[model samples]
Target chain A: MLDKKLLEVLTSPPDAAVAIVTQGKDGPHVVNSWNSYAQITEDDKILFPAGRMNETEQNIQADNRVKITISNREVQGKSIKGTGFLVIGTAEFAAEGADYDTIKAKFPWARAALAIKVESAEQTL
Target chain B: MLDKKLLEVLTSPPDAAVAIVTQGKDGPHVVNSWNSYAQITEDDKILFPAGRMNETEQNIQADNRVKITISNREVQGKSIKGTGFLVIGTAEFAAEGADYDTIKAKFPWARAALAIKVESAEQTL
Candidate 1:
């Protein structure tokens, strides 16, 4: 079971650093950085920023089942780590939401974005 | 950076499900299961259970750096995921510590075990 505090951080409406590992022609490549979490629905759909030309977005388009690792740390000396399948069923530019103005106003660098449906979840220690 | 509560669960001495992705002779493989967390030192050393003949232990012995994903889900509609470098420096039987008796008494299936040193850490969403 996941600890209460760790879960809250993951489900909270904030940006988080997501590490995406994919099988490239060269080898296994990993990208580590911060991306804003725009929306997470009760049905397990998660929206995040993914520029058009990024390797992750491309890989997701080619392969639907991509492994994503999400994590958060707490001051109470604990941490939560979630590993699951990030099923990318759709992609679009972030110009169609109520928060679109806010996102565009703040993140002018994002060229494109994507919406991911989390098909399954498992708690990790 | 990590949220306060998430960090507490990771550093706590409870067991967690660690997804270890490794490069095998065949191809990239992943193992999803649960393991007990014995000790996490101030120097970023993390100890977990690994039998002598497990594929993960063998891979760690051959390769120093292994990708480990840890996760937790909360009742508050949040989750935390942590991805980091698990450096396996040492491996030993659990019969030489104060907690050894307890661990052995509880987990008789663990034929051998390992102590991992976490060299780096990253939070993911």
Candidate 2:
């Protein structure tokens, strides 16, 4: 699950970039998302809307293991802030289900929902 | 190789975060870098310092494939900018070599040098 620092970064900028890595046939693939439809449940489950994600969606279906990293939007202190968090998780696409509908309701542009269960988390402090 | 747009993003902020993904035994791993020891050669090769990068270094040694994502530090449009870039490349650690020495000279904190040859690149417009 995301800790205090991770939550701070994720919730900082609503349209902040979420860097996601998924394995592909050629090699590992990286995707940048300014997810307007991202959500976090009280249980710490990450909900991401899938809006026309092709290779990323396919990669997850083949293997659910993914890594995500985001920078802290605010300066941590008076010094130069390089605070970042890396999240390792398993992703499941919620297509045409209750969760999908909820995400769609929140973001009309969303076509499906990506629910992520965190495996572990780390940071560059 | 990195294209015009990618170069723009990579060279924008001196210490901007670099989100990197590498494959491991258990799953994919992501690392964020504020690389004060990164260099770009005229031939389009990426030189990054391997400053105590344990897991990431091992992963690249086992498989050179890696994907990197970075957000543009500047706005690209008249409205809100959400420009991001993804780089697919192969990495090799350079230890006790000419490149390693060069990196060490530039960044005294560098332990080794990681050279990356670009394979392909994409983006989230």
Candidate 3:
């Protein structure tokens, strides 16, 4: 299951950019998505609409491993006023299927759905 | 030079978390920090106080190349309300010296300084 605090951060007003990190051939690559842009599936998988994640898609083709960081300044942390979480997972982009259908419904501009099979979601604030 | 808009976002009220991504042996690793915590140096380098980035420090030692994403919902973008940037850079941790001193002064709890020599800071949103 996803961390409850992470769910709170995602549902609340976003105070920070969500980061998606992937390993490229040259080095590590990073991209930004809004906290509210992420959706959690019934099975607890995380999904994001991919409008133009060309490089990220290419990287995932070679290696499915990915890391994502999401945070919210409005959420309470274990010892602080704000909180964040680090999500380690493997991702695959789908243009057709249930995941893609889910994302396309909410984000009409989405060309693909980035589905993440999370290994862990750890609070890191 | 850093993007002027990015500087504006960094200096203004933070609306999001900044993500620092590094390549680890296992996969891409991600950590979060607040946008307001970043400081621009006279030489145009970016600095962050390292509270306990043990894994990040280890990754930097093996490979200095890094990718950082920072964004602000309050900043105006070229074609939207919010703005974001992708920073490609190399990083080094400093325990002592002018760079370390700069970070230590502002973040008293910082054990080391994470200094980034930016190759590019491109506006992504």
Leading candidate by TM-score: 3
Task: For candidate 2, write residues B1-125 as lDDT tens digits.
Answer: 45677767666643456777888776677777653345887677777777777898999879888877766646362244646666778888888877787778887888888777888777666
- Model 3, position A111, has a per-residue lDDT of 99
In order, candidate lDDTs are 0.44, 0.71, 0.88
DockQ of each: 0.08, 0.42, 0.75
Clashing pairs in 3: A15-B15, A15-B16, A16-B15, A16-B16, A16-B17
Question: Candidate 2 overall Cα lDDT vs. reference?
Answer: 0.71
In the range A4-118, model 2's lDDT, one tens digit per residue, is 7777766664345677788787677777665334587766777888777778889998998877776654536225554666778888878787677778888787778887788
Badly placed stretches (over 4 Å) of model 3 are: none
The local lDDT score (0 to 100) that residue A4 gets in candidate 3 is 81
lDDT, candidate 1, B1-125, per-residue tens: 33344355454333334555554443333444343344443554454554443665555556545555543332111233433222213333343563444445555755544444454555443
- On the 0 to 100 scale, the lDDT of residue A115 in model 3 is 95
Give the TM-score comparing model 3 with the true structure, all chains together: 0.96
lDDT of 1 by residue, A62-87 (tens): 55454444443321222334332222
Docking class of 3: medium
- Candidate 1 regions exceeding 4 Å error are A1-7, A11-16, A33-38, A41-43, A51-53, A75-106, B1-20, B24-125
Fnat for every candidate:
0.00, 0.50, 0.85
Evaluate residue B55 in candidate 2 and report its C-alpha lDDT on the 0 to 100 scale.
Answer: 90
